[model samples]
Target chain A: MITTDLVPPRKGSTMQFGIFSVSDITRDPTTDHTPSEAERIKAAVAIATKAEEVGLDVFAIGEHHNPPFFSSAPTTLLAYIAAQTKNLVLSTATTLITTNDPVRIAEEYAMLQHLAGGRMDLMLGRGNTAPVYPWFGQDIRQSLPLGLENYNLLHRLWREDVVDWEGKFRTPLQGFTSTPRPLDDVPPFVWHGSIRTPEIAEQAAYYGDGFFANHIFWPKEHFMRLIRFYRQRYAHYGHGTEDQAIVGLGGQAFIAKNSQDAYTQFRPYFNEAPVYGHGPRLEDFAEQTPLSVGSPQEVIDKTLTFREHFGDYQRQLWLIDHAGLPLGTVLDQLELLGGEVVPVLRKEMAARRKAGVPDAPTHASRVKDKYGDAEPRQPRPNANRGDNVTGGSPYQDTDEGVRASLPEL
Target chain B: MSDTAPGPAPVRRELRLAVVSAGASDPSSTRMLADRTVAAAGRLAAAEGITLRVDVVELRELAQEITTAMTSQFLGEGLNAAVETLRTADGIVASTPVYKAGPSGLFSAFFQILDNDLLIAKPVVLAATAGTARHALVVDEQMRPVFAYLRTMTMPTSLFASTEDWTDPALSKRIERAARELVLQMDSGFERRVREESWGSYQHSFGSAGGTETGIELDSDLMRLAAGGQA
Candidate 1:
């Protein structure tokens, strides 16, 4: 019999399985024909929809401004997908918080929140590109500050009413408000994404937000240090114990009926993938990085090993698309993932959790309760009127003045 | 009916402006920067007694389109609208956060897909937000070069701010100064271009490249292959 102590249970039913598409519209080399941007785009939509249909929790899309990569406007793409799908949480594989203006980020996401019906979240990163900054009139040196300041502003924009703000990087505002209030009176959750930046982990912990260690490229040790640092800082912030701090991870893997066939079929594609080509051995990558090439059980076993280092996190997003693999091969991988991999993983995880082991990261688990339940619940306001309040304005003076008049302890 | 037409019909001119904010938060600093920039543009429009139609595109809600199936339609239309409006606009106020030593990936991605000629000669006011006073140089070190590459007539005065600056009065003054300079530049640029018939005519000459389709097929077979017959 399998020892329950060896495997841990998850926190909630919301299993966070995400499918990320690189958004390259190029044709497969094996086929010698590229898909139109339209077809590639449609394929992305179908994939996301299928992820949801298969009961996978989230769908993320990467952002690449260059040609062959069709996705340049991830938010606009998510909004369109939001209109078509339901329940499946929408996110970006990498939302460049470094180059884009925080103001546009605020306005666009608010609009998306309205469109997505609150099924939205984002992973903020500075990105790996160098030439992209000049294309947008920005310097690489300012990347860290831009992420920090922009995220700060983004946070306030979602939580505050009117804003009176001034900063070194941007102009000041006496009273500013982004339009299209979020659905259900709640702003979308934020997950700070980072590969090597310990600062990002610190920021996430400082704000009591989720830290997503997209471990697609780095080794487990690096991610462990970052996650551990975040957990320690989260406790420092008086939010909770290290174990209670929310975390997420990113992984990449492929599975087949047999381990050898999985590696054989995946080797060429891995060797050619623009993101990972000419870097390291596929086996090495699979060992150090989150890239797992094997059967369904292998993927499960490898993923479960994450707990040994980083402890329990709130979510896990997987990158199943890379190296311009043919759509057929990708679908086969997904089928194996959804049918064989996820089921057994879920059962094993649950069995472990039932025996008092730790659980996976989840949205509900990450919601920081700053205030105790002793505080009276506030009534929901009219959706239209909610947009009228300004950030700096005294809420007590507004139409819902009575509720806004509540005293802060 | 007169040839002179009563002193050039009072020279009716309208200023179109586009303000892009890349933050996903409501009361975000980038939005504040955009507001300050827009207010400055509004002031310039008021000084010139011109009607200004401002269009603000917030990037957070729109970022999903950067990666998903909507790349071809909604995002395309949205970007087209933004580009067309910008091509016809007199000014632009672009704001973003500095991430990983550059601008946000979403903001950069948005600009990456835009046609190179769309921003040429447009008066752009650039601003950035970061965590520390140290990161203030991103506007100059990072954002300015991108605007310059687009051949935009970027105002020399760019604003950078950090957490400490958010509540500082001096930062507000700097923003005001940038706003003032932007207006002056817009006024001079608009006047010079109008006299030479350079603004609207150039845009007309270089109308959007609605060229014939490339007829390239994204390998549906590869997509099927990638999907491994799951579809």
Candidate 2:
């Protein structure tokens, strides 16, 4: 059984600050050298460790199934990072909900939670790459229903000891108990990430889960409308008032001691940035979107405005490590961010934050919520049943009602 | 016309008309065709005691921004304003100069980038100007289908003018007919009525239609599924 002593103390502040990387292995525009896959992967590990050393609270990595991106296996990297840090909340920027089997997600993430001693959470997204869907044997056309249904099954698998589920996208499962059940029997918190899909926001709100807006590319007015709708629906579902809904936003910045040096150093990389390279002028993009490339003070000022636009959000993550900046540059970014920007922004955000808004969810908080001062149930299997099909009480402490409902082989 | 004692001025209904011209030159016939059509439409609206709030989107002025938006998905201020005009316009006059054998790439690319739901049920008059009459079919054959796919109610009289055709009287007649059709469609308030009444029936992406489609239908199948109801 897991005890209450294992849970960490609740954080003093409500907001969490961190950086997330897409793990893209690109040619450094200035040097014209591309890091090998091994080198990029190691660099990512270093970045995460540096994030913790610099006192950032969270670190997230994205997942992609194509070339130019190296984070196809985020949980593996996050688990490794989790072992190296004690306080950093390791997470995925987004885990594809449409293609991967929900059953595997339940098992893999639960295992990761146990390995990390409960310092993990996840965000779900329907990946936009059309070819990746087919590679994973899913139809992109049914992505909406597929994502929604998969999350439903995954939710039950984590909470319920036994799951008998049937859904359109995958074959039905009977008598499935995802192994290594969630650490202390407390499921990891989930945040649904969406760029422009209201259905995703509705799903997140329905479950009282967090909603993460991809607040980087498009105009704020678009994200503002989407987040407002999510907040309204979150209240409609009886989760909490609109202000209490858990919210996270994405942003990107490049910082130096002075604004001019920051701009001059980052312009070449910005001009050739992935997905939006050679498009809008850097000045126009910075003015229109959440991308801030300037002094530390400038980055902080721009980031602080997020509170006014998105209300009091719980988590704010920036994409600072992409665009093939050398690892040393990225490390310097961490130094400036942790040493200068975040300290002031944290105080400012706390001062501006309203009363009664909840802090960002963490594993320890979830465990405390479930068991309070009581010991969390750690299930132990009953002496092996001859063949593994027939289900009686699988665990010693299995509830009588649950045991009685188990299916016979 | 005889002046009479103006007592309690008539409440002239206001209609938004968007004129999108792809003419790249100052003395281009494409803009001329669009202007003639807009003037004729104005006269018809005047006959019906209506006022047209014209919003002209010259594709040439927005060429660089359009390409940028296409590549980066970042809608610059000019492109955003253009989309806003298209989103709220009651009627549209899409004028383009034919290049090679098709409508100008600038013209087609501009419409292609707009959200599909932005133009639904809106009336449009398709007009094209080409160097030779041989390219006259580009308007009806190539451009009409794009608007059709966007669900626009294109007018029956498509206006086309080549160098020689612009000098003929029939071109003006065609423009006048197209204008009358657009005015008739706009005066019926069809686009406004359809959007106001049955918008939920049509599929819309999140923040689509210039961030105006924000209403979440709680009873939609996707919403039900999102709430954990069965597929």
Candidate 3:
């Protein structure tokens, strides 16, 4: 039996470690077999379940409208994973803020938060796929404004009872109350994930949200500058000190019992992976990027260096299941991660992490933050005002004297 | 408008001259032409008592890396170094051998893959080398528009050297004229002035210039929208 005894117990609040999948349906080059969509979907569910089984803390999935990626409906998949696991925090590697309607995001994720008992969060990204914009009636050139406006609306949808919103990207909302108000009336925490965009970082800092850097595929110098900017801006916006800012990072690693065995095993996958395939040599990629393909100790050593570059971060999500690695290989990879890599990383990180650094944001901590010792607000819709539009005070506890305004007609 | 602070006096001690030559062979004529143009430009700058430090980005050496960057978005060491050199360059000499009556594909691909905002308002001298004078218009007709799209100031004189022109005085005359225009543009400090005065007006993304354009303008419309204000 693979025991998780080495896993660091959650001590009030500490760093959270997990795996994030882009839900890619790549062909396994070793076996020359491609998993069908149905098979890949099942594999994704298994991966999330296995992540929780091995004492991992979070499971985040990506959003893609294109083929070769199975996760178009992240909440549906995450909600299902939520039902299967007890302690895992379900999230999205990124939800397309540029393309998806924020109303749907507010409603769906709020509902997922409720279903998962507030064990959920989301990372917003302006997706790289340009064609996805027009399919959703958006222009890619305006993605920055579209993302900022959508998040602005989504932020208020969870906080305000009834929102009257007018923005450039979307139609106006008059007395609109997004239903199934967030679990315990506390919205799921948000983390903005960006590879290079500072406006996204600025957006994250402006709202005091977490900033997640997808730390794979590129050198650390590029990410270091952006992360530094985010931290300073977070402090500038009065969220907290730079060190207290919540930061998450994404990485890719392949580990084994020995360094040579790990490299030999992963060479085919590295050379054939979709993103960097037929491009850089495996050894060069391993040397230049955050990709760690070596023994568990080696992987752990490389991962520990992240804190040195980015400073004490909160969440670290790895991309272990992509590049057409079989389900068995992925499970073994997770076992190594949970049984050896993360456990050691946890202790080392905990020892080195400075005092006053915040842990990854969670629903329980956020709700406690909101309520303190008092009872949390339970929003109850007021009596129907005879139309689809909500009253000025949609909920009973909005205010004593607030009322709806009718047209002069 | 009133918030603009004249921060520090612009530094103009040494001008960076980046020469991007797309010749494939060793001691290629394209590079020779580029070298001649650079030498002429250097002489003009020395006459003005300005130091011109040159950085040559031989695209032939970076051919594989450029293709890799285009395909995988992974910039190798050489390509990144070249980008950095070009990013800091005050003036540029772009010399490409005419391939099938056009600029070399490798040369065009290098600039095509760079961030659109990287070369904004920078001065460039366009030169092309071909086997015949029939392809002389290639620099004006083909390349000027590409540099135009990048918002670079292509010098008024375009340099083209055919097999015979290399031995002719007219080629020397064109190079001298192009070099003069380049030195004048660089000495004018046009790029530094525009970037210092109006960097925000140009369309830019974070990490555009090899991750150097990280300035956050808080007063932008997008930043306003980020702060929950109307766009």
All DockQ scores: 0.01, 0.77, 0.56
Better of 1 and 2 by DockQ: 2
CAPRI docking class of candidate 2: medium
lDDT tens readout by residue for model 2, B1-231: 011212233637778889899999975789899888988898788778777778889999999999998898888899888988888788999999999899999999999889778899999999999999999899999999999999999999999999999789998899999999999999998988988899888887765577676476677889899988899
Question: lDDT tens digits, residues A1-409, model 3?
Answer: 2223464556335899999999999999999999999999999999999988888898999999999899999999999999998999999989998899999999999999999988889999989898888999999999888899899999999887777778888988766778889999998899999987777888899899999999898889989988998999899999999999999999999999999999899999988999799998788788888898898888988998899999999999999999999999999999998888888888888889999998788998998889998888898877876765446877888875555343332
Give me the candidate number with maximum lDDT: 3
**Model 2: residues with Cα > 4 Å off, grouped in runs:** A1-12, A386-390, A404-409, B1-13
Report lDDT (Cα) of residue B153, candidate 1.
Answer: 77
lDDT of 1 by residue, B122-173 (tens): 7888989987777878889888888887667777778888898878888778
lDDT of 3 by residue, B1-231 (tens): 001111123423678899999998979999999889888887778777677788889999999988988889888888888988889889999999998999999999999889788898899999999999999999999999999999998999999999999789988998999999999999998999998998778876766666655466677787777767777
Ranking by TM-score: 2, 3, 1
lDDT (Cα, tens digit) per residue for candidate 1, span A101-168: 77777778767866876577777788767888878777777776656766777777766655556655
Pick by TM-score: which candidate is best?
2
- TM-score for chain A, prediction 2: 0.95
**lDDT per residue as tens, model 2, A1-409:** 1111222222424788889988899999999989999999999999999988887888999889999999998889999899888888888889999999999999889999999888888999999999999999999999999999999999998998777788888988777788878999999899999988888999999999999997999989888988998999899999999999999999998999999999899998999988988999998999999998898889888998899999999998999988889899999999988777887777777778999889888887787878899999999877766786436456777764664344554
User: Model 1 chain B, poorest ten-residue lDDT window?
Assistant: B1-10
**Most accurate candidate by DockQ:** 2
DockQ of 3: 0.56
